[model samples]
Target: MRNQLAISSLMGLALLAQTPIGQAASNLVFCAEGSPAGFDIAQYTSGTDNDAAEPIYNRLTEFEAGGTAVVPALATRWEVSPDGLTYTFHLREGVKFHSNKAFTPSRNFNADDVLFTFNRMLDKAHPFRVAYPTEFPYFTSMGLDQNIKSVEKRDPLTVVFTLNKVDAAFIQNIAMNFASILSAEYAEQLLASGTVRDINMQPIGTGPFVFQRYQKDAQIRYKGNKDFWAPERVKIDQLIFSINTDASVRIQKLRKNECLVTLNPRPADLPALKADKQLQVIEQAGFNLGYITYNVRKKPLDNLQVRQALDMAVDKKAIVDAVYQGAGQLATNGMPPTQWSYDDSIKDAPYNPDKARQMLRDAGVKEGTELTLWAMPVQRPYNPNAKLMAEMLQSDWAKVGIKARIVSYEWGEYLKRSKNGEHDISLIGWTGDNGDPDNWLGTLYSCASIGGNNYSMWCDEKYDALIKAAVASSDRSQRSELYKQAQHYLKQQVPITPIAHSTVNQPLRASVQGFRVSPFGRNNFSGVSLAE
Candidate 1:
C-alpha cells in the first residue's frame, strides 16, 4: 500500500514509482513548526496564519522570490492614475477556484470577485461584511478603509479602486497576504445559509492548491489544482503539512525522511544541517525584526529615561551572538535594513550599563524595583529563541540594578496578554508583509495600533503625523524624510528598542526543487516539485 512506503529507504523515489501515481511524483510532506490559529491571513497577521492561508489563495500581485519586486498574480496587468489615487486592474481569464468536498466556484475569476473580496473589508454596509464578523486585522491596521474610497466593477474583467488620498505603499500593499482574493460565489452561498463557519477551514480561492482537510495541531492536507492557470502545473499531486511544535522533533523527522522539508531550525543546528549531505539549507537575510517593547502605560516604563536606560543596558550583540549564532544583523531602527527607506543613521543605543544605572537614578527610579518581563513561548521566523533572549535581558537588567521577573504563557495567550498592556516589558517583533516603510512605522508605532498589535501602547501624535504624511505622498524623497524623522522619535524616546533582523533558515531535502522562500519570509510552495 502507498501508506506503507518505506521511510528508511535510501533509494531514490524513481525506484518506488513503478506505480502510475508514483510516476506522477504525487506525494510530498513537510514539517511545520507550529499549528495555525486559523487559515485567514486577513484576520490574523501571524506567520502561522500565513502558512495555512497562503497555499489556498492568490493575491492580485505578489513579491518575487527572495525580493520585493512586485509581480502580477491573479491580475494579468494593472495601471495607476496620474494623481496616484486611482488603480485599475485587469483580471486574468479562465482561472478556476479550487473544487473539492468544499463548495466550488460557478465561474472564473473576475472583477466581481475582487469587488466582493475588498468591499467586505472596506465597506461596512456590504452584505457579507454585515452578515459575518468584519474584522480584517491587517487591513484595519493599515487603515485601508480610510485610504480606499471605492471599489468599482468597471467590467467583467476590469476593476478600479479610487483612494481618498495618495498612498505610496498602495501597489506593494495590495500584494500582501491580507489582500488574498476570495471566491465571491462561495462566500455568498455560505452567508446565505445564515451560518458561515470559519472561512479558513474551507477556504475557496483561485490558487494552485485545493484545501482537503485539517486536523488542528496535527496535519493539513491539500490536493493540486488540475485546472491551474500556469502552463507548468504543480508537480506534486498531494501535499501534507505535518504539525510538530517542537524543533527537535521536526529536525528528527526530517533526518528520518518522515518529512522532506522543515521550518525554523535553531541557529545552533546550522553546522550539522549544513554538514548533512542529504539536506540543503536555504538561508537569507529576512525582512523581519525581534525586539523588546516597553509598555508606556506602566509607571517606570512610561518614563523615557527608564526606557532609554533599559535599551542602553541590554547588549544586543551578546543576544545576537548567543541566540542568533551570527545569523543576522543588529537592528538600529524598527524597520529591517533590507527594507527601502530604512534609516541607517538611527544607530543602536550604546551598551553602557553604567550610564543606564545613572540614568535610572536621575529619573528617581529606585534600584532593585521589581518589574515583569514577558517572553514568547513559540519560535517565529524573526525570533528564534525568545526565552533565551528574555533570560539574557534579565541578566542585563540585573547589572543595571533593576529586578526583573521573567514570565511566559502559551503562544496565543502571550500575544493576547501583551496586546492588552498587561506587562511592564515584552519580547516581540514583526516580519514585513510588504516592502513599504509605512508597513513598519504606520502599522506599528501609530496611535491606531494601540490596544492591538502595538504592544507598547506608546503613541506620539507627532510620530503619527509624520507617518500619516509619509503615506500621503507619492514623492520618494519626501516620504523618506518623513519616515526618517518619525524614526528619530523612536530612537530618542526608546519606546521600543529595535533588536536584530534574523536570517531565516528553511532546510529541505536535496530532491526538493523550485521551493523559493520570499524575503518577506512567506512560504510559497506552488512552484515546488519533488524529484527522485
Candidate 2:
C-alpha cells in the first residue's frame, strides 16, 4: 500500500547522501521492462527510450518526478512573447556535459548546445540530422517542423524559439523526452569524423547521470555526473538498466534483491510484493492510454461501418478484467482523464454484437471475413499484455463471424512494421509525453502523424482544423470546447478504439530510497540512493 505519496518521509532521513549507505554498494540496478530503441529520444516514441534518456539528459523544462507539474530544468527560467509565438530560455550556468571514452566535452552546456538540439530537429538540412538520418517519430510525427519556425541563440546562455503560430502547450512540449539537449561540440566531432552513429550509442548531456555503455537489448549502464549544475549531486554513484522481457523473471530478480528496482511489475504480482516485508510497491494513476487501431487502408477496414463494427464487437470490459487483473480502467475517450482538457464525457463504442454484425453486413463484409490483428510484443503502461488483448479481441470478433489472424514481432520490429503500415489492425497506445491535450490529440490522431504515430491513417480536414484552432488559442475555455468537439470527431471516425489506462505499479527493495514512478511513465534515478 506504500506508494510514491508515502516516500517523502522516508526520503528526509537519507537526502544528504550523494552515495549509497552501509552496503558499500553505490550502484542501483534496475530491471527495465525493455531495452531502449536508441539513446536519441528525439527519434523514437516508446517509453523505453524515455527511460534511458531521462537519466542521461535534461530538457529545458521537466515534469516533476512522480508528478505532472512542469518545473525548471536545464533552463533556469523562460519568457513568452506577447503573441505566444516566441519563447526565450535562460540556460543554467556551469552545467557540464557528460564525458566518456567515445567523446569529451571541452566546455559546459550553453546556448550553442541548445541551438544544436532544436536546430537538428527543426532543420532537415542541419548536418547533425543529415549526417545521422535516423527516423524522428515523436518530432516529425508530431508535426514539429510546421509549428517551430526557427531556433536561434540570443547569447551564450540564452536561446530563443520562434513558432509559426500560438501553441499553448509549447513549454510542456519542450519538457518532453524529444527535447533533451545534446552537446553540439560532440555532434560536430562525430559528424566531422564520419562516426556520427556513435551519438546514438553514446549520449553526452547535462543531466544528473552519465551514459557509460549500452549492450543492445541487454543492459544500459550509467554513472552519476558529479559536476551536475544542480545543487545536490546525484545520490547514486551508478545506475544499470537491465533489459528483461519476462515479467515473472523481473519480479523474481526484485524479490531476491538482485536489482534494487523493477519497472512495471505485473498487476498479478502486486500482492506478493506488498506482502514481502523486504519489498515496497509504488502505485499511481498513470497518464496513459491503450487502444486498438483498425488500419482503415486495408480491405473491409476501409469501410467506416466495418471499423465501427470491429469496435463494437470487441468487449473491452472483458479484456480489462481479464488481462489487467484489476490494474486499469476502461478508457473513456482517446486520452486518459489525467490530460488537461481531456473529454472524459465521451464514452467508447457500445458493445453490441448484433448491431456490429448488421454494420459489417451493410459494408459488404460477409460472414467469415478474414483480417489480421497485430499484437504488441512487450508489456507497457498502456498495455500490459497485448497478446492477451488480441486473443480476447479474436474471441469477441469470432462471435461476429469474422476470422482474425493474430501476429506479432519483436518490440522494435513491431513498432517499425506498424509505422510502415504492415498490419490490418494493431494494438498500440501512448503514455502522454507531455501533460497537454495536444500531446494526445495532435500527436496521435492528426493527419500530420500519418507516417508515424497515426498508424490508423485517419486524416480529416475538420479534425485537423479543430486541433489547429485549439492549439492556436491561449484561452483554456476555448481550447476545452475545441478539444471536446475533436473528441466527438475522433469517436465518429472509428479509426482507433480506446482500451484502458493502467495504474502503473513498480517494485523496489527496502534498501532502495527516493525512487518514484513518473505519471508520464518515465523512470528517474537522479535522486535515488541504495542502502544496506
Candidate 3:
C-alpha cells in the first residue's frame, strides 16, 4: 500500500512538470497566503489584495522592481511645476487594454482612463461610484481627496494634475498598488450594461497578465498579456495564485514541486528548508510593523490609563521569542527602524503586570473584565503566527485580572470587521507602500483614516498637524524633525503597541529564477520564469 501511494505521488509530480496543452511547464504557481478581499485594489488595503491586482493592472507610475524608487509605467514621462502644485504626465502610446468575454477596448489607454481611475475615487458623485457605492480606503487615508484639486485631460496622450498644496510624496503615493489604472472603456461598457460591480470581479487592464478566472479561497488564474507594453518582461505563459492559508501546507506543496514560489515560510521550518537542495530560501529585512491596535472608541479603552495598563501587561519579548522565533526584532516605534525619520529614542513601556493591575483598578476597570482580542487569520511578514501571539497576549492580560477572549474570522471578514471598529483590540500590521514618512504617519493615524486603515480609531489634532507640516515641506532636515516629534507623540498616545519588525522569507523551487524580494511584501512575477 505504501509503495502504491509513493508511485501515485511520483506520477502526479511528473504530470505537473510536463508541458501540457497550455504549456503547464511554463506556468508559475505561487502559493499565496490568502484570498484577496476584492480584485479592485482601490477598494482594499491589504497586501493579499495588492498581489492579486498587480499582474492584472498597471499604475500611472510604479516602484522599481524589488526597490522603492519610483519609475514610469503607463505614463512614459512626467514633469512637476516648480511650485509643486501642478504635474503633467505623457502617456505611453499604443498600449492596449485586456479583452474578456464581457468587454473589449475600443481604443488604446489614454488620458481618459487615467481620469476615470482617479475621478471615481476623488468624486463622491461619479457615475460609476454612485452606482456601486464603495470606499477608496487608501486614497482617502492618504488625504489625496483634499490635496488633489483636479485630474484634467490635456489631450489623448497627456494628463495634468493640480494639487491644492505641495505634497513631497505625491508621485510615490500614486505609484502604489491602489493607484493602478483601470480601463475607462470597460467601465463605460459595464455601466451601460448595468453591471458596474463586474468591474471589480472581471478586471481589465494594460498590464503584463490578463485576468482569466477566480475561485474564492481556491485559486486565481491569469494568462500572459501578449499585447503587454513591455512584452520582454512577461516571461511566463501563465500565472496561478494557489491560495493556501496554512504555512505548513504551503511549504509541503512547494516541496512536492506543485508550487513554484511561496511566501512567509514559518521560521521554525527554515533550517530544514535551507538544507533541502531542491529549494532556495530568500530573506530580507521587511519594511513593516506588527502591532496591537486598541480601538479608542471602545469602553474602558477610551481612557489613556487603561490603554497604558494593557500595553504594559503584554510581554513583547516573549512574543518575539515564541511567535517570530529569532526572525524578528522588537519594535518600539509605530514605523519600522529601516524607514527614514524613525525615532529610535522613543521607548516601549516595560512589561510589569503588577503595576498594570493597579493602573487598571485605578482607572475603574473591574477585576476579570472581559475584552475581545482579534487575531489575523493570515500570516504576514511582520506577524508569522498571530494565533500564538494572541494566546500569549491573553495569558499576559490574565495576570492583570483581565479576561481576553481571542477571536478570529476569515481574512476578508477579519479586515472588514476590524475596519468597522468591531474589535476592542485587534492584531494588525502594515508594510510601507511608498518609502515616505507620510505613508506611515498620515495613512495610519490621520483624521481622514478614521474609517479606513486607522484601526485604532485614533485621530489626534496635534499629531495630524505635525504630519501635515512634515509632508508640506520638501526639506529633509525639517521633515525629519517633524516626523520625529510625531513618533514621540504616538508613543505617548498609546493608540497601538508596536511589537516586531520581521525578516521576510520566501522559499521557492530551485528552478525558479528572477524572483525578487519586494520590501513592500508584494509578490510580483512579471520577470520571473521557470527553468527546465
Top of the candidates by TM-score: 3
- Please give the clash total of every predicted structure, in order: 0, 0, 0
The prediction achieving the highest lDDT against the true structure is: 3
lDDT of each: 0.82, 0.84, 0.91
lDDT of 3 by residue, 262-290 (tens): 99989999999999998999988989999
Ranking by lDDT: 3, 2, 1
Cα-based lDDT at residue 511, candidate 1 = 76
Give the C-alpha miss distance for residue 370 in model 1, angstroms.
3.2
Cα deviation at 512, candidate 1, in Å, is 0.4
Residues forming the 10-long window of minimal summed lDDT in candidate 3: 14-23
- How does candidate 1 score on lDDT? 0.82
- Compose the digit string of candidate 2's lDDT tens values, residues 108-170: 889998888888887779877888886676787667778899898889999999988998888
Q: Which ten contiguous residues of candidate 1 have the minimum total lDDT?
A: 8-17
> What lDDT tens digits, residue by residue, belong to model 1 across residues 229-338?
88375777877787788888888877767777888888888899999998999977788999899999999888998998999999999998888888878888888887
Better-scoring candidate (lDDT), 1 or 2 = 2
Model 1 steric clash total: 0
